[model samples]
Target: PEHFLITLALPAETEVVWVEDFYRGIGDCLDMFGGFLAGGETSGVPSGSAAVISIAATGSVQREHLILRSTARAGDALFVTGTLGGSIHGKHLDFTPRVEAAGWLVRNFKPSAMMDLSDGLGKDLPRLAKASGCGFSIDETAIPVTTGSTVAEAIGDGEDFELLFCLEESRADGLLQAWPFADLPLTRIGRMEEDGKEQALGGGWEHFRS
Candidate 1:
């Protein structure tokens, strides 16, 4: 619920209709996100097997408001919202998404590319660069490392759930100055380099490795 909220910036009052197997505190979790359990299914699994739950959601937005990662271009400045790393220490489950910040950005400046940092900056940044047909040069020192998190962890610790985006370099300062989320920390991390030769970073969660 929280992840989708930040991803889409849907209204808090919006309800999430879903279906799922029975689980303790399920209703409570939905309530926390201002969602109501519209309908669901319940069943018992084999005694020793783990139960699985699946949820589906829907939201609406005007066509003009859509943003995509492929729009990034050379000379665009990269920025990240909120701290990174050590998400395993409660940040992943508790941190709020940058929905409001993203809205403000779209309203004030046109971002060339945008995405959430779920699979770690190291892994995700390359994907964004590829989609945009550009390379990226990031300043390690400018990355916002969370307390108790090393720079490496900030690069690789998956589930940070912050926003990473690129915008025109000329508008970077004005956007930063007009940013409305006083509580959310925003940092300029890098720029889009030339296409075809990407400077990639190491570390990130891999679902499968030998």
Candidate 2:
């Protein structure tokens, strides 16, 4: 209670690190906050031989980038884990992260790679491409923007709280057909290919460069 009160007195964007030793006894914390325990099965199936939860939190309003650009591949289909935009209106903080959904995808579909979308597509999509060693071509019309947000806001506005990922081209159709609305609205914005560098077809947002 004291720590909670202290935290309250700190600031709304304060970062708290509850566990310094990830291997110590953070299982309970992970379990409570969308984390699956290692050595235990997730979604009723064992996760090979190596599985564990790790986290790092700090005090500061920092932009988090999950899923990487190095793991994507040519002919891979791109996907967003949940609905896009409107985070400013309240959904970003209240909505659940797509950790479980990502676990399911890794275990079931075995995607080439995955990442959560924190910053808007403008920031994230490029990261995905950079991580996967490939470039992407996004169809602006197919992007899933929030109801009240404009296309630019949906693409550039941070705090959408979604996951943008890529899977083999072959599984794109099946993935959409199998789980249309698994948690948030999913969309096939584009496909991955070898383009030498990352560049958006329409345009994307940039923190330092635009």
Candidate 3:
């Protein structure tokens, strides 16, 4: 009983061979996480229009096991997998998603909240906290920075493709010992709080601000 997935992509105005290559890449990426490429609609733009590719995906998970950012309870321990930051140095395009690791945790820890760190921790963590009606404090010093990456970069550079989750504090020690991936580090960075000052949180995304 796998949580089957269907993904689709449509690339426009490309040769048949190139389209095949794109589909192959998309299939491979989805296959890495027990998913299949289904299909996508195509819309070709006029000449001199910017190149565009559209993709969509759907997945199914049991209602009881579904993890969400808006459900972390105060005092739950926060964690993130793998080192963060410096993805722009090349890791972003080549990073591995923590799909397997997430499944493992679901089968074991039953986290209170979870989400992928697509945006930087600085941006995403606050979102999770806000949605949960709680506040958070992360130790910037404990952020697992990639080699040659600064703590600031780890806080804001993003593209880590890691698992950010919360678990009951009582089970935290067991998690530390029972984690199976020695190659991938699981870091306990912070925790949720009931009465924390939310004013310190900032998104740090520079591109678009309103």
Q: Count the backbone clashes (under 3 Å) in each candidate.
A: 0, 12, 0
lDDT of 2: 0.64
Q: Model 1, stretches more than 4 Å misplaced?
A: 1-40
Q: Look at candidate 3 and tell me the lDDT of residue 83.
A: 95
- lDDT of model 2 at position 178: 76
Question: By descending TM-score, how would the candidates be arranged?
Answer: 3, 1, 2
- Each model's lDDT comes to 0.78, 0.64, 0.79
Candidate 3 lDDT over 121-146, as tens digits, reads 88888888888998887887787999
The ten-residue window of minimal lDDT in model 3 covers 1-10
Clashes of 1: 0
Instruction: For candidate 2, write residues 73-170 as lDDT tens digits.
Output: 88889887665777667667566666567666665676776766677788778777776678778887888888887778778777766777788998
Candidate 1, residue 157: lDDT = 86
Best candidate according to lDDT: 3
| TM-score comparison, 1 vs 3, better candidate | 3
Give the distance in Å from residue 200's predicted Cα in candidate 2 to where it truly belongs: 2.9
